[model samples]
Target: MSTKHFLRGMATVNYFADNVVAARDWYSELFGVEAYFQMPSRDNPAYIEFRVGDDADEFGIIDRKYAPEGMQKAPGGAILLWHVDDIETAFARLKALGATEYDPITKRGETGFVTASVVDPFGNVLGIMYNPHYVELHGA
Candidate 1:
């Protein structure tokens, strides 16, 4: 029997922050776009979402208070990475924007996959990678 690939693709990635507005502003500055949606009200939103990247992926920020009951307070766990054209430049820019390094850039084998992670100022883990496969498939 052949194994099925149930996970189609990344639908949305959400990060928890104590201050959703600040997170929204920071990400808006980084992506050069504003959040297209917010919950409740703009001035007191609990969640905000932005459509980013070539694929127009949804990136969301939610107030930590709304996080699952057992969510950890520190930045750690499954790091969902986003593709980047240059890992070094992206890592540097993240650092310059006040994100602390969680993992240094690493070349995975020889398949042209380089990855790095950082903790955003809001305590969310943000990962970036230079993936040849993604570039080949997406052309970006």
Candidate 2:
């Protein structure tokens, strides 16, 4: 007999916030996604896991209450970058969903990559970048 194992992919990106409910709703609207799993707690009534897309089984969200203490208090200077195919479309969508723009789109070096940042309802900084070369190289 032979035994085989494999690693699938990133299951989710965990972010922390002071207000989980507000953060959850903000992210849902920003990504145009929905919540497939939500775990409530008295200490943090908004602990939730949001689906990244229509495929509910893949990606999700972990509210601050559910995250460890270190993650929960991560500084604002620590930005989380999310890779996307279209920076303009994603930025516009996030803006439409009430995300506050932290910075306009800018290219880093000559890599043909554009990036921008925004703040969620609870002040966690999120970044979106479009980089075809990166996609080809990293397979995101």
Candidate 3:
């Protein structure tokens, strides 16, 4: 039997924050673009989103109050590494933007895969990577 590929691709990744507006502004500075969507109302949004990267992947910020009960309010979860053209520059910018280091930059083998992660001020882990394989398929 052929194994079906159930997980197709990444659609959206959301980070929670106590202050959604602040989170939105911070991310906007990093992304250099304003959020194109906000829910409920801009003055009192429960969620906001941006279309990121060449593929326009969904990156969202949600109010912490909307998180499910028992969800951990710390930077511990799956770290989704977004590809960056310059890992060092991107990592440095993240630090300069008030994010703390969660994982330092790490070079993986000789295939040109590098990774780093940081905890955003809102306590969500944000991962950045320099992935050659991804570039080979997607371009810089």
- Alpha-carbon TM-score of each model against the true structure: 0.94, 0.65, 0.95
Give the residue spans of candidate 1 off by over 4 A: 1-5
Across residues 6-29, which tens digit of lDDT does each residue of candidate 2 receive?
755556666666676677667666
For all candidates in order, the CA lDDT equals 0.93, 0.67, 0.94
**Order of quality (lDDT):** 3, 1, 2
Model 2 scores a TM of 0.65
Provide the lDDT at 72 for model 2.
37
lDDT of 1 by residue, 1-109 (tens): 7576789778999999999999998999899998999998889999999999998999999999989999889999899999999899999999999999999999999
Number of the top-ranking candidate, with TM-score as the measure:
3
Model 3 lDDT on a 0 to 1 scale: 0.94
Where is model 3 more than 4 Å wrong at Cα?
A: 1-4
lDDT of 3 by residue, 1-140 (tens): 86767897899999999999999999999999999999988888899999999899999999999898999977897999999999999999999999999999999999899999999999999999999989999976
Q: Candidate 1, overall lDDT?
A: 0.93
lDDT of 2: 0.67
Provide the lowest-lDDT 10-residue window in model 2: 53-62
For each candidate, how many residue pairs have backbone atoms clashing (under 3 Å)?
Answer: 0, 0, 0
